[model samples]
Target chain A: MTDNSKTLLELRNIYKSFGPKHVLQGFDLSVAPGQSVVIIGGSGTGKSVSIKCALGLLKPDSGEIYFDGEKQDSAKAVARIRERTGMLFQGGALFDSLKVWENVSFTLTQNQKMSRKDARDAAIETLKKVRLGASVADQRPAELSGGMQKRVALARAIISKPDLIFFDEPTTGLDPITADAVNDLIREQVQALGAAAVTITHDMASVRKIADDVAMLYDGKIIWRGPVDRLDDSGNEYIDQFVHGRADGPIQPSM
Target chain B: MIFNPFAAIGRASMAAFSEIGRLAIFTGRVLLACLTPPIYLREFFSQCMKVGFFSLPVVGMTAVFIGASLALNIYVGTQFGAEQIVPTISVIGITRELGPVLAALMLAGRVSAGVAAEIGAMKVTEQIDALHTLSAKPERYLYAPRVLAATLTMPILVLIADIVGLMGAWMICVAALDFSGPTFLRNVWQENIYENVSVGLIKAAVFGMIIAIMGCYQGSNSKGGAGGVGRAATLAVVGAAVLILASNYVMTSMFADT
Candidate 1:
């Protein structure tokens, strides 16, 4: 095995801006194989921007994003990199026109060119992995509860058996207990598949359950990052303020 | 005491012109991207079914009724000439101009509005972003299929429109206008040409592309939430209808002698 292949995805000195407002500035992060790296930040603090840049949805003004140690600057490389990753969006984002199984099997049917029956079988298996009943597969996303929709989104994300997965605000809108369940499910899936994960959320509860390593984003840079066990005693005031959910801290709101 | 309606109309007119200019440039870029391909055929077929097949009933009904009315009007005008001229003008006008144009406008109202609303909601819900994250190109997965389907199906719809319209005109001429069957049939066939049918089909195809692309573009770029999706749908239908009418004039003139 190659030395860098142990690290599934890496971002170095990434920068992105919209108009005059810079979103990501010299951000550096790496996900070791099978590691769950959770990024915690306030809304609009470049957490989603970092994920978008890695997926090539938003172009970075400067810096390198590497998938399996290969830079993702060229179109060919970007396509190659993206094919190995999957994402669960905040809203579940399932196609309303599609049945739940169709949504889960979308990538396999569309990108991988799998046959419909084969895709459906894979979708059912993934649903089982996410603890969704097989009977729920034929129903549309509109028929599902909020928590059920999230589970279906999880099924979709893992259906491809992606080497890396990005979870964007996975627990944002769910009730606390449901959120905790989702967090546990995320943890279980990462471990079961031995896939690296980068989950972005503001919820400290999610971070506690899902993160092997936690990174705190502020002002376009990662202000603090370490093993999850060290988050409480990171000795960084910013991390402390954020983890504790204090409004008044070293970090100030803009006027 | 009264608002200056003319000024509001003038401002709206200017905004519409500017939007047209901007969309033209955007369309050129999309077309350039279209040439480079890893064509997503299933997505394209799905969208084609959505935009074209699903839109048939509305377009067909509009054309048939319009044709019936046109025949009646032509018969009334034909007091200046032989009654046989009603069939000739009804077939000529409807086939060469009205059928394609009206079908397109109807599609703009029905299918384009639906496309805009659907995609706009998708955008707001981050479904498009989800597609991107799944390693699928949104343009290919979403827009290309829609554009291709509309382009392919419009000609067929317009042909159906022409036939159905002629039938409507025939029914009106025989029953309402008291024109004889043999006379109506002869005049209608005599006035129709391969060029007329081809031109109308061509116009329908172009209008389909315009409707689908405009809807997809507006929806894909929608901002905010419910308000944004509403605006996108409204704009898509209104803009597509206007473009269909404006382009019909231009296309009709181009194929005038044909």
Candidate 2:
């Protein structure tokens, strides 16, 4: 549990399951203002489920998710909470029918009720923030490469200047070089916005690049969490096994 | 590899039922979303144009041929000394039921199929997810406009079908049956156009709702990869067509004299 005052988003004793498969069991996480928390876990470790719960995409069987010191209970309150945050899904999730700028400003145009011309202008400016040229504004996501698509996704996430962001496997299928570039972009944007960030990923390199705080998940719980600099010496066996990318360690793999 | 065909079929049946349950829940949520804030008027109008105006040609063609055939059949029946009742049967058959139901079926094949494919592909590609992330309700952004448009436009399309079919019957009477065009027109207008056209429009409105709901529902609930999108498209057409015909019969019986 956090100190209650300094946290931007907080989850306590979260428990979730799908049928017989228990994906998250008593998972807890606290993200502070302007902090970059990267959650490292293997496949099916409840990372995605945890993020979905916080975003109201999935309801936890039993848990408490707080945003800005307020519980998201009523529809009005939930909408208010969502308005302050942005998300980058595992896939780019761009609207193929919409041009890149339109996709980027979708929130502003649709929710904020801005004019198309004004939203497009805002979108181009946001695109520039992610180091994309204005030319990409008119192109579709299909016209871009994988790396470019990620940048567009990033642009869309940051267009509203959200106070918090959730990145779901931000660099999952990218090449090493592109993945590294994305990691740097994530770090730069989070710092520029001075916003709290929670990223779910399995890439150790990505954690090193983007995370100020690192948390390792295993067997439906947070096995270890600490500052990124202390990751190598977390002294937790699961953390050590995962950080080293080794198959043999004190942590046993279930068949 | 112990394979039981019956077990496989049973599992498939269960999956189908599960899918239906999921769609019912989704429909409830979409209906709720429609009532919430942030009405997308522009999108709704655009979808109306797409579902209504663009679907006329196919529906028109089907209605004309069906009307001509019905007239010919009635004419043949008249030759057997049932001449006095031909107008009544033809008027009730084309305007009261066949025109709207047939037009709807044609639109379901043409419009519903396309809507499902478009929405299903959008679902798979993450456009729907993107909308959600942007704080846009996918239902309002995607479904509301489409459903509303289909509901409003269908009746108009059906009315057009009614007129075209009447024209087809006129051509049949004048050119084929050797009856004067004025007489055929007079008989159609006097005996049929009032009750039949009104009834047809009612059928068109109901059919429109069915087609749009099925199409939007299938597309919005599509799963898996390319194959999932393909299945959604197929299901939209098949489901809309069946519902259109079933609803047509139910409405006709409800409106017809005992």
Candidate 3:
């Protein structure tokens, strides 16, 4: 697992289960520094669970998570990893109680103890990177449109210029055009920051747009993974069926 | 059929025990977090406003009404000869038992439900998870502020309730029951003031801790969707109310001899 010096994050033989349902079983994946890895999977395929496990939000029953070449097991280790990582939850998960700017600069002000004025300025600057105007900074998340909220969340995720970022369905509720714009923005920001990114998404277009590498998760394991160019011709039936969005292939719709 | 019945009973008992264990552990964690550093002063003040200041009106109104009703009941129950004891009895009852218990019950309905709904919504929307990713401990940032505010504020609320309740009783007795206001006040002040008020305040603090803990425990464990949040709120209110009453009985027993 530590063979590659460039590997920024690795999940080795991870397993997670809730009650009687096993969500992840022996899941394995690795991401290199400055690379964007998009995990593609069908519904209920443990994509979110895997990301949560990696982030220490959910503890895996077995296996280890390596972040920046160090094991993340203890609470101290997890906190250190989280300090350098940013996450974009599927629903934006903006603190409804805080203004948009406050939400964006929450880590900066609360954890880093930055002055409010400085944090607000930094937040506005980050918002601009996501193509949001300064006018929206003082507004609440509910006041923004779905796309605008997504942009705010994106801004919040990258405001600290984290060493690693995780995006959970960044384009789930957006229209195709807005989704494409978000994908483009995410790609541009990740490239500019040169940070490793892990995006879990079911949107094929997003996978195509933001992924340097694509991994398919099915039945609690990564069945196929390679460069984005290899996704269409992965030669794995599960990956082929998923990428093509076909029902007749080896994967039957779970009823 | 026999085995099925036995298994069902065993499973239900185990679930109940597990739930109690979880709540106890959650309460311990909240206490530990309170002792730790990185206290969120802003959140604590906001919670104080929500749990204490904003609840003054409802707690006050309930206290006044209960006080008046208790006075009327005592006047009716007493013979003409024993009617002079009304003021002392009303004051003793309000401060020693009725004031703290009723105020806590009202807050359990109001504040506990609100905390559960707010935190449950946060859980459902992944804000709790978002906080974790931001390297913020939910127990420190969320639970400690709430528990500390509630525990510290409940005594003040009970103190207010006691005064309002006694005033209501005095007003009712003097105006309608042919009693003098000065005489009634004198009787209320002369009868075990320190013992009654102190016991009530102590109970208020303990009740406040229970309310906050139950609300947060149910809310933080909430799952599913809107339905789950609703259930959490309902359970929080019910749990807090029940715990307040049950603990009140235990506390009263302990304070009875004193």
Candidate 4:
């Protein structure tokens, strides 16, 4: 039951398949504005694919994706939708050829045609928001540690002040402290920007910290969804097994 | 047995056609991206430096040695009787064929492999997807600049290669063939200058486009991980070299009467 008026993004009956392997089948999700929804699922599930579908990075074989209550089907419409959204990739995905500042302000300089100096200043400001310093502006992504790289990526994601943001495994490969820092930064940034955020992560700690609502994706569909407070007591067996980190559950480990 | 053979042939033919169709679509997309707005001039210039300027030493070395060797072979073939004509033939040969073909082969080894590896790595690391999310078209921002740079700079590289090759031939002719230095230089300068050089340059441009397109295509489609990037690089070189040779044959035939 999604309120159409407040829903920023809606994906209905999404189906996506890669050749013989069916990845997503009848996946449905709806994200409201200013809300942070974390989609949790086991590895090899369609969590990332669902996010990609929402971002227009991957096209679903069948289904409807609506952005701001308007159907997005054409390339022009997808481009328009993407222009208003930001994404933090699992690997940070900072351009290796560019400096940190350039990577952060890439959308501003390349798309919005902002001057290099202004973009650099804006980038440094955004980096500050992510707890990074102005000194890192000139360095490359390779020069930064994993946590620092994630911070830089977060800065880049929030630099444009997008209406919507997506985080794919934001705290995948970091120490607990660093991961918590990144999670806090994400929560703060999403709240500060008042953007609709859909984070695909397996980190339950991240879900507890950043999620307003938690949706569990299984077999390419949202099997359970509710407020973050109810995530531990969702009364769904799959959600219980997943949240408690039990291997013995409805989900079988892939060989 | 008949059915099996027919099925195998059909499968092979289908695979070939599929590859060709994909390549055609990729080329069409690249052309469309080039014509569209928001061209990345900065990326284009950087690629020009990488694909053209940085390739000078290897291309130059290859051209020189090939030119010298060609001259020596021609001198021996003619029994050293037609000393004067040796410079003309060698110059024409280097300018018309060896310069562009050899330079392209070298670039196919160096530039194509490099582009494929770079783009493949970017793809694997999700930088390409990052570009898409940033509202920047990858073809315009990444592929077009490289393809355009290689296409534009190749002719210039080939022209320099032609000159250097002739100088190399001159060195051999004057020292080994006992030909006067001035006479060798004069023959090289006067022998069908525009026609020979233009043909080589044109071939170089076409070869450059092939190299870049192959590299970008293989890389942009790369999957898996480090192994995938390595495969892309290898495929880029092999595909570019084969295409370069095939295009060279067609180009030579077209310019045969000229």
> How many steric overlaps are in each model, in order?
1, 0, 0, 0
Best by DockQ: 4
Per-prediction TM-score to the true structure, in the order listed: 0.90, 0.89, 0.97, 0.98
> Model 1 chain B — which ten-residue stretch has the worst lDDT?
B26-35
Better of 3 and 4 by TM-score: 4
Interface CA RMSD, all predictions: 1.2, 1.6, 0.5, 0.6
Worst 10 residues of 1 chain A by lDDT: A1-10
Candidate 4 docks at the CAPRI level of: high
Report the Cα lDDT for residue B176, model 1: 77
Candidate 1 off by > 4 Å: A1-6, A253-255, B1-45
lDDT of 2: 0.84
What DockQ was computed for model 4?
0.92
Candidate 4, residues B1-258: lDDT per residue as tens digits?
346988899999999999999999998999788777767999999999999999999999998898889998888888645667788899889988999999999999999999999999999999999999898888999999999999999999999999888888888888887788988887777878898899999999999999999999999988899999999999999999999999999999999987
Model 2 ranges with Cα > 4 A deviation: A1-5, A250-255, B1-37, B80-88
The regions of model 3 sitting more than 4 angstroms off are: A1-5, B3-6, B81-83
Task: Sort every candidate by lDDT, greatest first.
Answer: 3, 4, 1, 2
Q: Could you give candidate 1's per-residue lDDT for residues A1-255 as a string of tens digits?
A: 112357778899999999999999999898887888999988788998999899998899999888887989899898887788888888899988889999999999988889999999999999999889899999999999999999999999888788888999998889999999899999898778878899999899989898889998998998888989999999999999888988899877544
Which portion of correct inter-chain contacts appears in model 3? 0.85
Tens-digit lDDT track of model 2 for B209-251: 7888888899987889789988998999999998888888898
True contacts kept of each: 0.88, 0.61, 0.85, 0.97
